[model samples]
Target: MDTSDVAETLDHLVADATDHHYSPYTRFDWVDELDEQQWWMTPDLLSVAGTRHARELDEKQLMRLSKWEAVNFFSLNIHGIRELLIEVTRRIHTPGFELPSEFFHRFLGEENGHMWFFAQFCLRYGDKIYPDKSLPVTTTEEDTDVAHFLVFARILVFEELVDHFNLRMGRDATLHPLIREVNQVHHDDEWRHIIMGRKLVGLLYEPLRERGDQDLRDRLDLYLRRYITASVQSLYNPSVYRDAGIAEPFAFREELLKDPARTAYHETFFKRITGFLSSQEIISGSPFEGSRV
Candidate 1:
């Protein structure tokens, strides 16, 4: 990667951003078509779907959990997109983002639209947004290279994490049509963001990689692995379990994490992102690698 390469990448991204222009206002049909008795997400996609716990659940209770799980998923999307909006917004015209300002504006607009739709789903269906239980962690490394890498990495990984669910639920016939549509729209929007994010991170990291600063590299990798783990853990909101009528929500979540089946399922969410990052040599080993989580 050279200086010209970075410019060429940014130029392409700007062109793509302009070509795929969209308006937040007309993106989704905002009418309330939710049925009270419908499964919000596919049953097989639930965290407890394959476990004995799901077996023990009656149809009514299972649907109850599905509704809450759907709400929880959308709520998490709201939070993640909000954070990304904040990250990109602050950098819109700042020193680090000037050259990419045009694309960043587009990125910010898309994120704002995503937040609106996601929050809209939670509000119309679940009646409120779920409180974010996922604690955000930041790297201690103070270098500009690490900070630049961290911001893009966070955005890219969050997209990867949630898009796994989006891609699955979007195509799943068992979920409500409205829910599936939402997922489909979100997955479609994130495809562009993911492309831009990956390129920026790869370009920004070239200097660090060239320097071969092992300690800084290790620090960044460790932060990413932890962030990956946290992203997976965010899905297991105890409040969601409680609202879904699961007893002792915290204890249940603890036990659920220990379930080999659930762990394996969670691992699937990271497979693509980890594979991409590793192939780029951005990371050596992923947090979701066997026995790592």
Candidate 2:
């Protein structure tokens, strides 16, 4: 993981960011209400999609679930953006991060706009934004290199997970125009972040690998795998199910989460990040194996 390998890519990303800048505030036309009959999210991307639980729902229930799930999706974005912002801000001008600091400025600004829009969508349409339930990842004080790698690796993992939804919903014609536009805007910006984050995470992980600190590496691997699982589990929010008028929301959540169809869907969607991590030797093998509930 030579640092020089990413300098040119970072410079190009900065140029692209500068050239394609937009004010997220005025980018879309908001309405007093979104059509209830319209799909807020693509049906295939729903948490319970491909499960027997989804089949039990009528059209109205499915649409209702879509609305709440879309809100949950945006809420996840708001929280994820906040965490990434804090992590990137901590490293922007710090030691060992000189090369990508320029792009960090653009990344922060774009992500702030992203947070605002996501919050706005959730509050205006759903009448509330769900609270973040993600557990914090704490680092030991002795291993600054490990801490640094985890910061960017978590960012990469997060962006990769969210981008799957963004890219799909962005192009999905079945969804409302507002939903599509919002997703497209996020998808456009996140592509750059994902690329930059992947390179930066790899660069940050090199020092730990070179030091041959097997214990630290093992710790990082286990934490990241758990983080990945937790990230996916957040999608099956019981609150979303209850808000959608589903009975026995908690049980529904548990059932859907452990559904084999949902598990396969998770693996399919998670392939990119998992493959990248394995290829980089950041983890030993497929993190999802025996990791899900």
Candidate 3:
């Protein structure tokens, strides 16, 4: 695209993002405390193991599982936002992307504030936050711009996965109002982020595909598969299982991976991600195209 076109696109995106700004403190009725007994933690929003295996537990066990999953999901959000903020800050003032960069600067600030509030909830109730154990991998080994582009693409994919849940839970009036508001506000911002991510990935892909970089393309496909698998597996939090008195957490995770119910749940969560990857032709000739959802 020409400079003028890029400038105009960036301006529109910034305006859209700016118009969605919401007050985190007043958006929800935070004054209403949630009771463990009254809190009806929806199984669909819980992690795979927590939801699937929750039927075997009693009331206290269920509550523990629900709280743990909530903590885990929000903790992941905190870490993910932190990483994205760093990337946004690095590019915000850089040349060529000044227009988009200005909006992203606001995004970074908002996400930073989100991290603080999420951390506060975890610390205040759980007494601590879970540590991030997921290992970061380079999108490709190639020493080219495609590698960097793929990194951002993978980040976008992850954001989409989170946004899927956020969009659903955000407006769910059935859940606690505070939880719903948090999700609602987050989904509003993330909708713009996802759109920007899609555009950025498309722009990055066009040139790389034009150059016919087979190795880079192959690596991108592999990275996408790895990310999907890792994200699904992340739903099995050992701490949650341990806290709920489940025996041999790692062994349980391995077993759960083989369960039909668990596998189906993972497929559901990854349906959109896989579809998008395929539509982008990133996995056109790959085995995943024929794999079961």
Best by TM-score: 2
**Where does candidate 2 clash, by residue pair?**
none
lDDT (Cα, tens digit) per residue for candidate 2, span 12-63: 9999999999999999899899976778998989998998867888888899
Q: What is the Cα-based lDDT of residue 44 in candidate 1?
A: 76
Candidate 2 lDDT score relative to the true structure: 0.88
**Order of the predicted models by lDDT, top scorer first:** 2, 1, 3
Residue 272 CA displacement from its true place in model 1, Å:
1.0
- Per-residue lDDT tens digits for candidate 1, residues 1-293, read 34576567767776776887677667767766576577887787676866788899898888888888899988988888888888788778888666677778778877888888888889988898998877888666578767877888988999988888899999998877778889998888788788778778887788888897898788778888888888878877899899988999999888777677776777687888898888887778868656423
Better of 1 and 3 by TM-score: 1
lDDT of 3 at 199: 65
| Highest-lDDT candidate | 2
Q: Judged by lDDT relative to the true structure, which candidate is superior, 2 or 3?
A: 2
lDDT by candidate, in order shown: 0.81, 0.88, 0.68
Which residue pairs of candidate 3 clash?
Answer: none
Candidate 2 residue-wise lDDT at 233: 87
Order of all candidates by TM-score, from best down to worst? 2, 1, 3
